[model samples]
Every structure is written in C-alpha cells, then in structure tokens.
Target: MEVIRNLVQSLVIIIILAMFLEMLLPAGQMRAYVKMVMGLLVIIAVIQAVGSMARWSFEEIPALVAGTGDGGGQLPEILEAGKRISARQQELGIEQYRQGLAQQVTALVKLNQGLPLLDVEVSVESDSGSPDFGQVKEIILTVSDNPKQTSPAPGGTEPVEEVSPVTVQIGSSETPEREEAVPPQAAAGIVDVLTNFYNIQPEQVIIIYR
Candidate 1:
C-alpha cells in the first residue's frame, strides 16, 4: 500500500512537471523531443508500479497462503506421522502388558508349586477390543504330570523336563506308580491368587493341562 501510494504520488508529480515544462519551452523541435521523453518516463513509472504489484500477488501471497507440498502445509503431514507413531506405541504397550502378566503368573505359580512340584506354564489373555490392557479377561495354564528333577543353573533356574512316571520292580511282582495330575485344591488356589491379587474371576481361569 505504501509503495502504491508513493508510485501514484510520483505519477502525479511527473504530470505536473510535464505541464510546467511544456509552457516554459519555446515552440521548436526541442520541445517535441522533451515531450516524448516525458511520455516515456510516465510509461516506465506505471510499469514499475505494476511489476511490484504482480511480484507481491503472484509469488509472495501464494507462498504465504497455500503450502507448496502434498497436504497444503507441513503441519498436516506432521500430525499424520504423529498419529501413526501413537498407534504403533499403543500396540507395543498392549503386547508388553500381556507379557508382563504372563511372567508374573508363571513366577508366582513356580514359587508355590507343592511338594512334588509340577512343571507349569501360564498364559494371560486380555479383551481384544479393550485399550486398557490391564483388564485381564481370561487366564490359561498347562501343567506337567510328572516332576523331573533338574540341576540348578549357575545364575538362573533350570528348565524342568517332562517325563512319564516310572515303574519299580519288586520281588516276584512289578509295581507301577503313575504320577497324579494337578490336584483340584491347587487349581482352586491358582484361581484364588488371580482373583485376590489381580481382581480376576474364577470362571475366567482355564487349566488346559494338569
């Protein structure tokens, strides 16, 4: 706006000067040349004003208003990237939650395995539609029948081996002692542990193998 105002004032001054110059010049070819030069100056001034306007409107204005790239601005692209990252983070969080729950149950069960302990594996399930992974909906367990002795590892507990019950030979007879499955009381104890500590329900627990 200021540039336009200055340009307009310059044009007005040029016109006034041309008019004054015309009267001061004596009637001759020199006056004709002077008039022609003044006309060219007027044209140049108008062109300069129009060029500035065009540069501002076509280049600066568009660059400022609309972004140059795919989504009209960098902000939308950044927001989309953030949304993807947030979704991935949520998936990782849910997986970690499930893993943690399974580990805790396994540790607790191993520590409490009764006299002639059974080898056990624990699995936890969460609601598929629930975003809050702490809400455990179901629990599954597998337990071995026979208790195989294991030598302790240097810095960790040794893995238990799955073995069938052995038979002992007596004089004139054979005695086969079959390993028993996990007891009902132990199963109930597992349900109680989850229910009391983790707020789970007894009906939600399933012992697939015992």
Candidate 2:
C-alpha cells in the first residue's frame, strides 16, 4: 500500500514537471503527445493516491505524521533481520579464528621439529576447565654476529654487522612431554606474533597433538 502511494506521488511530480516543460516548448505535434501523456499520468496518480489514502491503516497514522521510512510498522522487522545478520557474521568470525589458530600451530611444529635443544626447561599443569593449558612459557634465543669480516661503507667507515638467524628445535619426546613442553612456548609465540604483527589479541589458541 505504501509502495503504491509513493509510486503515485512520484508519478504526479514527474507529470507536473513534464507539463510545465510542454508549455515552454514550441507548439508542435510532439507537444500535443507530451501534453496527453502528462494529463493521463496526472489522472492515474490522483486515483491511486486517493485509493491509498482510503485504505490507510490506523496504525500507520503516527508514522505518517512523523514522516519516518515507509510510514509503516515494518521497521521492527528490518531491525530484527539486521540483528540476525550481525550474529551470523560473529559466528563466521569465530570459526575463522579457530581455523587460523590450527594452521599457526601446524606451521610452528614443522618449523621447530628435529632441531637441537640448547637449553631445556619443563613445566606442567593440568587443565581446570579453562580454554588455556595453564602453563606459561618464556625463552630468549641469543644471537651473535661474526666479527672477522667487515665491509667498507660509502663514507670510508665500517659497515654495520648483521646478526645470524637462530633456529629453535624441539626434540621428538614422549606424548606427555611434548604435550607439556611444546604447548606453552608454541602457544605463547603464536600469540605474540599474532598480536604484534596484526594487532589482534586472540580469545584462545589451542595446541593440537599430531
């Protein structure tokens, strides 16, 4: 009903504008056709407008007076639909986060496997219904640059030294050891990289056993 009313209103305005144009145009057969269409549109518009006014519901009177969208009670339905869409988007985001965490753990394992352990430190705690494994990890890899080689700079000064990349290896231990040792460090590193690189603190990242 509102659609019909708006359509009629738009048509009436278009016809009125077209009629004014016709009057300004030079008298010709084209003017005559334009005048005829304008008159027909005006009549149709008036009839539809009248029908819409007669069929208007009492509940719409407040909205019509307030000049809100559609002058109807459909706003609630639209708002509900928007809420559903928002909830669906949140669900998709959580699923994507889980998948990303799983991928990060897989990559970390592949990167650290079969490497020698320079220093070993072990800590263990059982889960207490929390998302985390209740273990904390902190490790610092000391890297050094070789002093034997020095390259000249453009200004006849010595070039800055470059530090060698350090590789961290976690040995293939028993399931219990791996489960206890690998999770804390790997999870901490994953969170650090994600937060520092992308500026997002993940809710939780679980390390899965292969």
Candidate 3:
C-alpha cells in the first residue's frame, strides 16, 4: 500500500512539473524533442516504481534520470542543435525583411521620377538581445544617369561602355564641372521622403551616384 501511494504521488508530481516546463519552453522544433524526453522520463519513473514493487533491480534508471549515461549526454547536444536551428530561422527571417524593405524604399524613391534609383540596400540590427533588434540601421540608394544594361549575352558577359576622361586646367579660375546623376534638390527630397516614411534619421539614408 505504501509503495502504491508513493508511485501515484510521484507520477502526479512529474506530470505537473512537465506541464509547467512545457509552458516555459520556447516554440520550435526543440519543443517536440523536449516533450519526448519528458515522456520518456515519466515512463522510466513508472518502470522503476513497478520494479521496486516486484523486488526487481533496474540500476540504469537512476543513471538515465541523473543524465550520467551515454544516452543522457545527448540532451545537451539536442539543446545546442535547437539553438542553432532557431538562430538560422532568425537569420532567414531578417534577410526576407531586409529584401522587402528595400523593395518598398525603391518604390517610394521611384515616385519622384527625377532621381534614377538603380538599387537600394538596407541594413538591420540582428542582435536579438538589443533593444533596437530587427530595426533598420542604414539604407543606401544607388543612382545612375545611365543605368547599366543587364541584357544577357551568348558569352555570359556584358559589354562595358568606355567613358572619356575630362580635361582639368592646372590653374583654372572657374570651378571645375561636376557631374551628378541626382541633383541636390532631388537627392534632398529623396532623403526627406525616406526619413519621414521610415521614421529614421537623414544620416541613416545615403545616396550614391554611379
């Protein structure tokens, strides 16, 4: 009667503890593995209790529960694997978010029509512990008056256009001519648009002319 009562109490305590741990566990593939381990533990406890009632010795049960056996060593490895999987998922998610943000920024810049935006690059905070995690860090806009043609060729190589060098006078009294794909006003407007829409600082948005 004493053994039976103790077995029931042990089972109840283990079940309640498992439920509590499940609630604290993060959602991912790791959760399934953890649940399986917990279930195995419950089974082991029951078997151990039954063995005691039958006067049978199961020496390995305690070792397994204490995580001292070869099989028990796998638990740490499983946890490490879960952490890696979670980190990889986070990286993929951040990349997708960056791509989407770049597209949106490109579209917004195109609304001006004056600034020839070739491409947009977005940087984001990747540290999960940081307060600004997942937030945009920087944005770079590539502008060009003559955008590079990306048409495929039979040789898998695109033809390069040669640019003539400008002659500079050694002691010119007048200011040298400077070429810009996007004008000052248009660039400022783009910076303003991006800053306002993204709620980021103007300095965080950069424009590069090619």
lDDT by residue (tens digit), candidate 3, 1-210: 676787788778877877887798769889888888878887897787677766522444434444446444355665665677789899999999999999899778777644666668999999999999998899998887653322234367754654657677887789755555456888899899889988899999988776
Question: Which of the numbered candidates is closest to the native, going by highest lDDT?
Answer: 3
Ten-residue segment with the worst summed lDDT in candidate 2?
114-123
User: In model 3, where do residues sit more than 4 Å from their true spots?
Assistant: 1-73, 146-180
lDDT of each residue in 1-210, candidate 1, tens digit only: 776787778778777876786788768878888778777877787787778777655554334434343333455655666666667787788778777777677766666754233333334444446584457777676655544433233477766566665556567475565655567788688778867877777877766653
Best by TM-score: 3
Worst 10 residues of 1 by lDDT: 115-124
Q: Tens digit of lDDT per residue, candidate 2, span 122-205? A: 222223354654332222221112222232423676545555455556895544321133334544565565445434445332
Sort by TM-score, best first: 3, 1, 2
Estimate TM-scores for all models. Answer: 0.48, 0.27, 0.52
Off by over 4 Å in 2: 1-74, 112-210
